[model samples]
Target: MRVLFTSTRGAGHFYPLVPLIDACAARGDDVLVVAPSALEPVLAARKQPYRIGGEPPREAMDAIRARAMSLAPDDGVSVMVAEGFGRLCTAAMLPVVEEVCRDWRPDLVLHETFEFSSVVAAERHGIPHARVAVSAGGFTAQADPLVGPVLDAYGSGIAERLLASPYLTRLPVSMDPSPYDVTHRYHEEPRSAVLPDWWNGAKEPLVHLTLGSEAGALPTAAGLYRGLVEAVGALPVRVLLTTGRHLGPRDLGPQPPHVHVESWVPQEDVLRGASLVVCHGGSGTVYGALAAGVPLVCVPLFADQPANARLVTAAGAGAAVVPANAGGEEPTVLDPDDVRSLGTAVERVLAAPSFRERARALADEMRATPSAAELVGALYG
Candidate 1:
C-alpha cells in the first residue's frame, strides 16, 4: 500500500507524522511525504523522501497575519483557524495535493490535523484518509468558528466532510482534555530516542527550554526568549535552551553560567535526561516531556497552546501562566516582565516531587498504548 502524508511546513505540524512514516517503511509499505519548499531541509535531514507542495501566495499570507493581529487574545485560536493558517494553507495546498493524489494513486491519505487540503484531495480521489492530532487533545472545539469559513471558501459543507475522517491521537484519555469523539487510534510517544554530545555528566537538575520552530518565528518571540533567559538565570538548574532556526545568538543578549543557548539541538536526546522543561506549550514538547517523565513550566503563546497548557496543569504534570493582552479578553504572548513570575513557577516545580511523579505515571500510560507499527498494520489490514 502507498501511504501519502501531507503537512504544513511548521515543525509542530510535520514532526508528529515522522514515527508513523518510519513505521510504515519498516513494514515494507511505500511512504511519501508532501510539504512546502521551506521544509526541504527538515525533511532532508530526516532522510525522508518527499515532494514539494508550494506555499500560499504572499498576499494571502499577509492577509492572514493582519487578521490575526486584529483579533482579541481569547479569540486567537478561533481567528487563527478562521482567517490565518487553516483557510490559507488549505487553499495553498489544494492544487498540489490534488495533483499528487491523482498521479500517486495512494491507498491512504494521512495528514496532520490542520492540513484540510489533504482531506479534500482524498475525497476527490476516493482514497481513505485519517487525521493525526498534533496536540494532546484534538483542537476541534476551538475550531468551531473555522468550519463555516473554510467550507465556504472551498464549497458548502466542505469542513464537515473533511472532519468526518478518522483521527489518530498520541495522548491517552488521562492527559486529553477535549478528546475527539470519532473513530480514534491511540499510539505511544512517536519520537525516536537519541543521545547528543552535549549530555555532560552534570549533577545539577537539567532543564530544557524551547518554544518550538513555529512559535519562535512570531514577532513577539524575541521578548519571550529574553524572559525565559531571565527566568533561568534565577534558577540553579543547568539549562539547554534551543532557539529554533529562525533566531541566532545575536537575538538573545546575555546568559548566565547555568544557561546554554544554541540555535537548535537534538530534542529527543535532550528530553531523555531532562528533569524539567520550560516551553511555549507546543504539543510536540508537551508530549515529549511527558514521554520522558519530566515536569514542565508552560508559558503559553498564541493558538491552541493555552488549551494544551491548561491540560498539562489539569493533569498535575505542570504549571501555567497565561499572559493577557491589552484587550483583556484572554491570554496571549509571554510578557517579558513576567520573568520573575516564571522563575517562581519553575522553582515550585523543582521543589515539588508530585509533578515528577505525575509525569512518570503519564509516561507509563503512554508506554502502554499501541505502537505506531501496530497502528499502521491495523490501518492497512
Candidate 2:
C-alpha cells in the first residue's frame, strides 16, 4: 500500500504521525511525507521519504499569525477553527499536494487533525484519508459553535470531513468527559524522561518549565522565563527550564543557583521525575505532564494553549492563568505583575497535593488506552 502523510510545518503537528509512519514502513508499505522544506531535516533524520511543498507565501503566513494573535482571549480556539486554519493551510499546500497525489497516487492520505488541506486534496482525488490526533482527544469541532461557518468558509459540506474520519482512534480516557460509556481506546507511546547528570542526583523537589517551541520564540516569552526564574529562585526546589531552540541562557537573564536552564531538553525525560510543571498550555505539553502524573501551572500564551489550559484545569490535573499582555494585538512583554501572577499560580500547585493526586488518576486512565502498536494491529488486522 502507498501511504502519504501530511502535517502543518511544526514538530507538534509532525511528530504525532511518526508511529503510523513507522508502522507502514515496518509493514512494507511505501510511505511519503508531504510538508514544507523547513521539516525536511526532521523527516530526513527519521529516514522517511518526503516531498517538500516549498513555503507558504509570506502574506498567508502573516495573515495566519495576525488572526491568531487578534483573537479574543475567550474566543481564540473557536476563532481559529472559524477562520479555518486547516482550510488556509490546505489551500497553501494544495498545489504541491495535488501534484504529488497525482503522481504518487497514494492508497491512503494520513494527516494530522489540524492539517485539513490534505483532507481536501485526498477527497478531491477519491483517496481514503484518516485524521490523526495531535492532542489528547481528537479535535472536537462539534463542541464549537462556529463549526458551521468554519466549514462553509472552507467550501462544500466540509464539516463532514471532521466527522468522517474514524478519529485516527479515540480520545484519551481523561479527556472523554461524556457520561455515555464509550469503549475502544488508543494507547499512546510512553514518555521516558532522560535525567541528565545535573538532575540525576538532585534530592530537591524538581519543577520543570517549558513554553513549547512556538511560544518561547515570542519577544514577550523572555518575561515569562524570567518570572519563572524568580518564582523558584528562592524556593528550595530544583528548577529545570527549556527555552526552546530559539532562546538561550542570555534571553532568560540571570538564574538563581537552584535553577538549570537549557535551550531545549527531552520534556518527557523531565516530566518523568517532575514534582510540578510550569508551562505554556500547549496540548502536547499538557498531555505529556498528565501522562507522567505531574501537576501543572499553565500560563497560556495564545492559540490553543489557553483552551488546552482550561481543559487541564477542568480535568482537575492543573491550574491555569493568562499572562497580562498575552492576547493583546501589540507585541506583549510580560511585566513584573504578570510574573508575580505566574509565580503565585506555581506556588498554589506546589502547595496542593490534590493536584498531584488528580494528575495520577488521569495518568492511570491514559495508560488504559491501547498502545500504538496495538492500534496499528487493529487498523491493519
Q: After superposition, how far is residue 363 of candidate 2 from its true place, in Å?
A: 1.1
Please name the candidate that would achieve the greatest TM-score relative to the true structure.
1
* Candidate 1 segments whose C-alpha is farther than 4 A from its true place: 152-158, 177-179, 188-201, 324-337
Give lDDT per model, in order.
Answer: 0.77, 0.73
Clash pairs, candidate 2, are 90-117, 187-370, 193-269, 194-269
TM-score of each: 0.90, 0.88
Q: Give model 1's TM-score versus the native structure.
A: 0.90
lDDT of 1 at 9: 75
lDDT per residue as tens, model 1, 184-281:
54555445566444536556888888988866676777777877877877667788888998898678877766777898887777887788999988
Backbone atom clashes (below 3 Å) for every candidate: 0, 4
lDDT string, candidate 2, 1-381, tens digits: 898999888887787777778877877888899988778878888877888875667687667677767766556555555554544555677788888788889998888767766766777788887777665442344333455455446567665665556566334555654222223456567657568757457688999988888777676678767777776677778998998877888876776667889987877788888899988887778877887889998887776676778888988888887767778786665577776777777778888899999999888887887776677667754
Error of 2 at 368 (Å): 0.9
